[model samples]
Target chain A: LGLGLTASPLRAAGLEPNSFEDITSYNNYYEFGTGKDDPARYADQLTTDPWTIKIDGLVEKPGDYALSDLVPQMTIEERIYRFRCVEAWSMVVPWNGFELADLLELVGVKSGAKYVAFETVLRPEEMPGTRFPVLDWPYREGLRLDEARHPLTLLATGIYGKPMPNQNGAPIRLVVPWKYGFKYAKSISRITLTDQEPPTSWNMANAREYGFYSNVNPEVAHPRWSQATERRIGGGLFAKREPTLMFNGYDEVASLYQGMDLRKNF
Target chain B: MIDVVNRSVRAIPNWVLYVAGAVPVIWLYVLGFQNALGADPVDAIERNLGLWALWLLIAGLCITPLQRLTPLRLIKLRRPIGVVAFFYVLVHFLTWLVLDVQIPSQIVADIIKRPYVTVGMAALLLLLPLAVTSNNWSIRKMGARWRTVHKLVYPAVLLAGLHMVMQAKGFQLEPLVYLAAIAFLVAMRWMPLSSFRQAFVKR
Candidate 1:
């Protein structure tokens, strides 16, 4: 899946960068399996070469764009961000990618575009966990047009100065640092500029359990587990779980949800 | 055939089971030090201890039904199984308390709000008395009441299975298999399906 490497100078969140082993091995890629190591074990089957993302809906540039053609056009930057999972675990990842806003501008979003919908590659044969119906395949995530345009949002193509390992979403993926990790779809194959809120895969599977806007809110607990605390990935067995922060500690993004009810949207 | 196997099993000291049980726990810690538990070692440890606890609980519950149905006379192993299960449960609880939850307020709130945690805690609470009373002294003092008190194992086992099912992230077949095994063992005790029940009653 290694096409080429482009260096990014743009800095984002600051935390101790987790080891490449920790970032690659421990993941929540459901297409592989629920176990953290399942992705690293099974993701080799995923063919990321010759990938094309179909940009459609309310964009002027509505066509399939090969990832090779897209990479050279943008300035890739290294963004070290704190990634928090909805399951109450976290890792600090140094991602390599350009801003999503740059890509949206390149596509020339139409005036009617209110949301940005993303879809992951649906290759059930390659992704073994898809056979179990753990989730609706072709995992979908969305961002409000404003959130999509946020400077912090990244269209990550690599991590730790290398092309992203298949388990961590090779070729291209979305990285919304302010939201839970699931909000950033991996192995993304499609991006739709839409007028309505796109139906997210997890929300479609179980709406009450997984809300449309899965912001990291400590006050609103998952039905089965508390979101108040999260264990850091590389922390040893006796390490204490740190308290989870609202918006995952990117307080600058708090203004984006101003006057909105996170509890209701959560 | 049953008599031969039973005699052989009886020859082994019961403390052997305790030692055998400790092997996995020690092995897990060794693996932990070796970093063999994979990327997230803490979560892996939490899961490993919980799974072993659930498996041992099911195995402990299976003892009576197995002894009644066959010439196994395996009742002697039941106490060791329950005691080991209790140890695993204690470790699992501590892993969650000291490592997973961390904050005392959050732990209290999780026990109160989260159904999975509540169910797991209830199961642990139910198993406490059985583990405490596993000795011959308690058995002698309680008399007929000992049997009645130990019956709590049935409910505790079911709850442990339920906790596994609930704790699973999605539609996991492994936890469901554990639940099925528990259901089958429990049914063996109560369900008067036919000759199985008659044989059990005759025993």
Candidate 2:
């Protein structure tokens, strides 16, 4: 809670920042509920204090690291990022955190590690929605080692110059700006470095609809809806949908999947 | 008891049912304009209108069933309810066309490619004739044919129910409930328990 935060100059592709109201009110935190505003109403039950992240599997230094201990180890920087949801909605958010690479380095990734798997906190009592099988419990996500180590990958601890709201992944969350919003798992409690490609919750739930890579590709449309364009959050009902950019406007990330077919991977 | 209720229902003119049928759509529009329909207002409005259309269509289906089971003369309300449901379906289609799929080309492709959209459009198209011939004048002109033409509503309702079930994101209970309700209503029309009892008593 006492982590010092310094604002970074990293701006998100010239996109205007969404309002604080828009950021907090409209969310897809399934742990709290499926509805956009459900988290804001129900996430108060989640206990964020005295939290710990269990880093194990393919790590040289594997142990439970308390949040207080981890925050002090690295300088927290505010990075404004353009978050694109798989549902064709976009938001520019100011996130306060350090790089996932830094956190992985702190844990000391072992030589055999090929992927980094992330797991959200699974306290059914605190999270009322877990009782229903909206998704496989303890929502899981994974990144290829290179993607995890990339400079753009961040472990966001807060947003809008404030610690994250309970509904908005309070203690810690992954923010891979290049991938869809669901790829960035929220309320992350355990991160396991593994050799095999880990199973992501959405991908496991519906492989055709949600792919493992889940890169922001305008070409690959979800089975139910088109993803060629996205409506910017806070934009009124009549606002025209802006053309969606491949890799969410971070074209540099294309090198991450240079040879592989995105459509097949997707 | 039936006579008393029918007397009260008659006292209230048919115009009241028309206004009552319109209230939900008006409420949806107000919520949408006020930005009170949560984050995705377009989806909310579209879904609400479609659901209401399905509901009114179902309600129209129930008219004969209610008459069969009870002394209620809800036959006069059927045309008004069907007409209201047609308007709701019209608005639902418009919301999808104007809001969701702004590109005219894409809308055509969607109607052709997407099974749910095709089914929904078919349902709407099927209801058009019924709505047009709902007047007493057309009823007199068509006579025996009018009743046969209106039978299309059952298939339209079935397609509408299927459209809802297919459109849902996950295994939702709401769409399933709508389908079950329609199924029950249709089954009641075909095999009313009272009719079975009458047959048994006659034997």
Candidate 3:
């Protein structure tokens, strides 16, 4: 099961993980609010205990499984990943979780399944941002079957060896290292395997700016801002922006795109 | 009440506006040094400066309409408010240039390629001439042309509001409210005082 236990090239390259305060405080969880600090301020209202993820659609096992039952069966490991936001900011996070592939294998993916769709838990009363129509409610995200099965893909349960903070998607969250941070759905409640391509929230909001496959590529700039460079969070006011790498420096996932023109896909 | 307010307004000097304008900037610097701007200080600082400039621009625009609609008069302070707004705008641009986008080539490319940056730059350019001729000597020398030159604030404020709307992540209400406020203020310039009185009286 331990396929690539080798030390991450990102860590080997001397990329220090951001302070836990930086990771927890500065978040893009729109469920809490739009401001960077909104999640830190408001997400504590969420009730993550006794969580159950609803699993259905083209799976051999389809039911509401409690998070406690799932954790005992899976092998949880820590992955240090470089997280890049579509807003042109980056952070190195020490995430502790199991691979999405392991979870799919346990659930038993059906032959007809071509894509994996995920949904975030929406409680308008708890989530203050949901009161406003900032986005279509219940933030949705998806991945091709191949991308879902990739070893790098993770459903993170904790950060920095500690249980995940409510602000940073407590209990469970998706983490696709190569893709932009928006692609990773937080505080996930549902996982569905379907043959058809699923709609993503940001792409639905503004198709011009956010594409379905939001892989971090410096060459394809966001309509309103450049993606060529990214400011590292927690870097002081004077810190210079470093040039962004293709696929956020995880070159192994480059095979996922093969011959598809990223510019058009972006 | 109007006489008392006007007398108090007359007592205050224009230089006080410039001194008042420096307060926010100084406060931001102090907060920045203390690392009190949350996790992303650079972003917080950048946004705070931009918002200060926007608020000042809106306040400057309010001067004319305030004088026209009510008995209160602040026409004498308009020039100083505008000049201070320009100063804030200049500092906001510098923050983006020096702190946010440090790369020189990317800065130039952003100004040319990105629509929001282009609009913001255009607004800054429009405000430049107004700030330059804000002094009494230039106003005396230019005579009637001075009013014509200062009229550029209308388009500058419009562009600044548009820039704010364009740069926001989603369909945010804050920037939209700023845009709506600017539009209403600009529209007020065209309507006659008699129509404003009629509309108020009808209600």
Alpha-carbon local distance difference test for all models: 0.87, 0.86, 0.91
lDDT of 1 by residue, B125-157 (tens): 999999999999998999999999988988898
Candidate 1, residue B159: Cα displacement in angstroms equals 0.9
Residue B9 displacement (Å), model 1? 1.4
* Candidate 2 per-residue C-alpha lDDT over A140-201 given as tens digits, one digit per residue, 9 for 90 to 100: 99999999999999999999889987877888999999899999889889999999999989
List the candidate 2 regions with Cα displacement exceeding 4 Å. A1-14, B1-5, B71-73, B195-203
For A170-242, candidate 3 gives per-residue lDDT tens digits of: 8899999999999989999999999999999999899999998999999999988899999988877777799
For model 3, the superposed segments whose C-alpha errors exceed 4 Å read: A1-12, B201-203
Candidate 3 CAPRI grade: medium
lDDT of 2: 0.86
Model 2, residue A216: distance off in Å is 1.0
As for DockQ, the candidate ahead, 2 or 3, is 3
- Report model 3's interface C-alpha RMSD after superposition on the true interface residues: 1.1
Scored against the native two-chain complex, candidate 3 gets a DockQ of 0.70
What's the i-RMS of each model? 1.7, 2.2, 1.1
lDDT tens per residue, model 3, B45-92: 888888888998999999988787778898878887888889889989
Model 3 residue A106 CA deviation (Å) reads: 1.0
